[model samples]
Target: MKFLWTLFILMALMHTSSAQQTQKPVLHGKNWMAITGKPLAATAGAMIFQKGGNAVDAACAMLAATCTMWDMLSWGGETQALIYNPKTKKVIAINALGIAPTGATVAFFKNKGYNFPPEYGPLAAVTPGTPGGLCYMLANYGTLSLEQVLAPALQLAAGYPIEAQTANSIERNKDQIKQWPYSKKVFLTHPGENREAPDAGEIFVQKNLLQTLTKMVETERAAMKAGKSRKEAIMAAYDRFYKGDIAREFVRGCQEQGGLITMEDLARWKPLEEAPLKVAYKGIDVYKLQQWTQGPAMLQALNILENFDLKSMGYNSARYIHTIYQAMNLAFADRDFYYGDPYFKPQEPIKGLLSKEYAKQRASIIQFDQNNPRIGPGDPYPFEGKANPYTALLKKRGYEMDTTKRNFAPVHDIRNTSSLIEYQQRLWLGTTSVEAADKEGWVVSITPSGGWVPACIAGNTGVGMSQRMQSFVLDSTLSPFNVVQPGKRPRVTLTPSLALKDGKPFLSFAVQGGDTQDQNLLQFFLNIVEFGMNVQQATEAANINSNQLWLSLGGTKNDDRKPRPGQLLLNNNTPETVRNELKKMGYTLSFGDRTSGPINAIYFDWKHGSFWGGSSNYGEDYGIGW
Candidate 1:
């Protein structure tokens, strides 16, 4: 009897352990703040927190570290952040988006008698804005010294192990890196050796970048000692990067390389402090980056969703996916047609594009059984649009009409009965498309084009400048409209996002794909806001129907591979049983790997007083915290 009792106890204990292992890890602390990015980046933020810094200090530390660890989105680039000051209970948006160079008007290219190249040209680059933005944030909110915030990054640059993600990103951009001697030297092994990843503990150093950071630190410190106030000191730091010796050398490099940027342009660059875009959903208030990116469109999506009974629609069901896709189609149509920097054009008419009244009318247009016969922009606003009343109200007040009425061409249509049959036959064949979306509601669609060339030519303080112009589209249809105008920021697809629950900030999410920003964001939102899953679980979910091609490809019926006008891609997560049911309902389908971009999120649990952060495992990256 004693032996039997002991055996039963052991069995019970084993079962409990198994259950715990499968459950999501729960981390809690009131004063605890977490930064999710590369491990080294997180470590940098953790250092700040340990030293009595707040969230802003930690964020600055992490940003600097990422500049060294993930050069793709670092200094000499652009960064937009949505800071929620728990103390003040107020949220502020920091817009660091670069503007068009002084001499870079669309007519300049036309006068030069040169067509824009699909990748890398004079038109692809924007003024680097990260430095100015960082300076502003530090001066206004940070407690730690600039040297303290920069120490981790400088140390990492001096010598640190190259993480797997960094190695992979380097390998992917090898062709571009080869174009610049400095980049090749730092990123690759000697002459012709293939780029290699440093072993976990291997020390990797970027001597040039370290020197650059050191210079900035010294200049800023000297300015402070010279009796400059915090703001002046910060501005001085910016001057060191954009107008001092660094600026001179960069301009010289640009002139030597035939790039368009000048010292004046660099000196004139300034970060904007605009009101954040906000929306209310399910009693929670959500905010986004602004009109410069797809930040406002996300609120538009949520507003339309509010009109539907998503919980009853069943998660990932054809009906749920289709409804969400239609909403995105309408929102994106407006984004491409009307959204741009308001400072440049006073009559651009993008305000109220996603108003509730607008969403209700748009939601009414989605068909339950048949896919939309065509895809295009909805009706224009009834009145002359202005930038006031906020993006959320705009979503509620915007007009809704037949999208096909606009000149926008349709990419897919579900009206083709034959395409549906073919897709169904290949139901087992896999299709994939990887995408990324963030909670900050700032989407970046970086294309490799001419705008990025200056970065490579100038060599930003030893760190390679961004070569992100590869994401620009060269389709003749968009050519007439694609000119560099003064004060007009380039169109970007990098869309970071925020999700709200019960009228409060719920989650911050972002993905990393040039044109795949919105596509990835839509699917991820469905997984959580609709499907009811944790952050990690939602991130790991499959990608089936992307917002970009869903409408033209026949809703959620077409195979993701060779997506036709009315077909939709379905991944393994759709379930065999449910998939067959959809096929019987005349939907075309194909199987594929769940292709999604790397997603990073920090979820707030107000009820529990804790925060959870996670990075996508699908990518070679990890999220860490203390």
Candidate 2:
């Protein structure tokens, strides 16, 4: 009996160790790999790569195709990307985020009785960015012509079988779609019918969008015929979009719909190529965009977590979850109050915010036994050799005066069950991610979003306007650094990431949930780095999301922007013991089968000289490798 019991125990251990499985197979490629939010969009990237284009070219093609597919975004959306340039041996940031149009001011919105900008329609738009962003990236870094890169998108505009997710979303939001003339004209093919929106898998076409793309391609061809360089030809197409016929129509439709966008806003707005911020964890260097995005918060969390023995705590253990939650809340508190447009007045204290010493200071105050619901922004100015300028403002707003002690939570936390559905829709609002890599060592990770379903079309252009302006706050008390102003870009939740190991490309990854992006990303990184999981395993790994920060989207009034303290989203597979432990620590828990991400990623295997692609099973995210 004793010998049989020992054999049974050994067999059970072996079974448990080998039980790890994924819903989708890990994609292996020798030459190239492309991943995105939709299968057809990934095919567009694969098409570009097959045409001998590099990673940037393939990524641009995927971006254009996804925009046409309306994968929670469109051409008028904003784009933020992290590109690894082989020649430069450095990661570069693409700041294609649109800025507030002229006449957009705090007083302008305050007079309208809005706490934040409206959530939809033309009034919510900023200047379009993705079109210029795609053009600039292609012209500078890509080896393909604009015509070739835009071919898939043009075809998509002409006609393609619409997917169920998008078709259903349009049908559900039909009433809002009816409000916009151009939207109703395009989306509701069978107007006044029982089911006006296109049925799933039905052929959906956008003639106006097809015409707009045709015009740009013609301009590019004309520029080339006139003896222009490749870059110049692409720029000509860009000029046609921003300063020519397309711009005029966009502004006209905007103004007719009582929007603030003007010709100057279109002409003056251009995509910027900037340096990305980086932080070293262990030996790997992680890169993210600047303060204009919520990316640095992840860096802050990493810095704080470095002080603890996370691996020793065990994966998804009670202590590990508690530690991660505390660290995220601490970082997010600072993000809520400090993150904003870096180009504007009163520059963000990024130097101090990302300081290792500041991270240590913030980490030292965490209560290991219970959740701290009163976590608020900390004073980072002192670390940067400056006095805390927001001291009075912090105290006046009931924040902790003692920088080292626990702080009061944000002023708003109204819980109303009636509006919970609306709030959740905005909080977990979806977008799409693009990841591409090729044999040349070039890699691209992009998180582009803004113009989603029910978006107001800009005139006969068939281009949806961006609704990114809602990210801005009207009251300085809500965010001193992110107040609404003309020409200032709103601090957005979109973030893309790149990591380098031993001075070579290691991982390129991104995801599409609003505030939940960084939270999932943090865990994904740790899963690989600490737990020794492969790229695919890490992507599908469970993650916890903290809702302790102010709502960044979907708020019409002040109460709607309130943070839900102690709220945490856990994976449904979490052990009951872990759940019980978290409950005792004051966390209000919610569970979902797919709690983490529809993350898309590519891992560069330097030793094997190949790529490993990962597309999580949470959504329709797909990938192709060859």
Question: What is the C-alpha lDDT profile of model 1 across 65-169, one tens digit per residue?
Answer: 766665345465666666665445566777776766666654565465434312332234566776777777777766667888888988998898776545654
In the order shown, the candidates' Cα RMSDs to the true structure are 9.0, 3.5
Give lDDT tens digits, candidate 2, residues 363-457.
99999999887898999999999998898887776643222221122223123122433333334446789999988889999999988988999
Clashes of 1: 78
Best candidate, TM-score-wise?
A: 2
